[model samples]
Target: MVFRSQRLSWPLRKGLSSVRVKARAKRRLFGRMLAMKPGMKGSLIVVVEDDDSIRSSIAEILEMEGYCVNAYPNGLAATEALKRTEEPCLILLDWMMPVMGGEAFLKARAELSESNQRVPVVVLSAVSERAQGQPGVKSCLGKPVDLNRLLETVEKLCLSGKCA
Candidate 1:
């Protein structure tokens, strides 16, 4: 698993239509591209979701794959954490939560200092419409997210060392 770090290739950036091809590519490319900072092992991934099971599952999966994860029950908690940590390499953000929704968090994140503003974000939501055209959001994943798809997207975004 490559640390979610770089701009994806064109086909991947547009979205990989061929799962078999992507899987093959993931297998072939992942080893060569594990580019996390030395001693860090993996880049940081922030997950904000109100659903405890969903948040825990995502965090567990990411951790199993070697990424450092911080899971939050709401955007407000995540925002506070992000402010203190290194600009995360990637954020897996859910659309709705009690204290602060993803939109508010995105807006708040953008308003943070220059470095914070550049952090890459991927929106995960049940409402497809609400997930579109979100400023600073690199991609969207529908709820009941396919684990493979989520992994692929994470690899595409993070493996290349291009994340802010």
Candidate 2:
């Protein structure tokens, strides 16, 4: 009688027998799940930056990491869009822009309904310290932002479910 181990060919059995292959697959799956953390799926992140390159790059990076992004050229456009669309999970605001600067946007955002006013803002500016005590401002990152730190801050805030 043929033994069970002898039923399969060596090549087929060898492919399935490697512990490294199984471990690698498990790690890949876990890494993907970790990248898009729970409570962050489908979350929208608004980016308001005057520089075309900066806005596009920021949006691209966030999208790659699994968050939906809506980028605006100026604060005025962002404020107007905010009224029409669902509230975003977070706003990345640049300090200076041609149409409406960050300060003006913050003021306008304050005058909105209570729900809109609660949305968290992260100021990305040359002088980020100026925004420290501002109401609704959750965090500040200076110009030439560290992408890793930005991601970490976003993960912390969004994971807490407070930004939603």
- Model 2 TM-score, all chains together: 0.76
Each prediction's whole-model lDDT (CA): 0.74, 0.78
Predicted structure with the largest lDDT when compared to the true one: 2
Model 2: residues >4 Å from true position, as ranges? 1-38
In candidate 1, list every pair of residues with a backbone clash. Answer: 3-158, 4-158, 5-158, 5-162, 5-163, 6-162
Positional deviation of 38 in candidate 1, in angstroms?
A: 5.8
The candidate that achieves the highest TM-score relative to the unseen native structure: 2
Q: For candidate 2, lDDT tens digit of each residue in 82-158?
A: 99998888899998789899999999998777787888899998889888888889999987777778889887776
Off by over 4 Å in 1: 1-41
Q: What is the lDDT of residue 122 in candidate 1?
A: 86
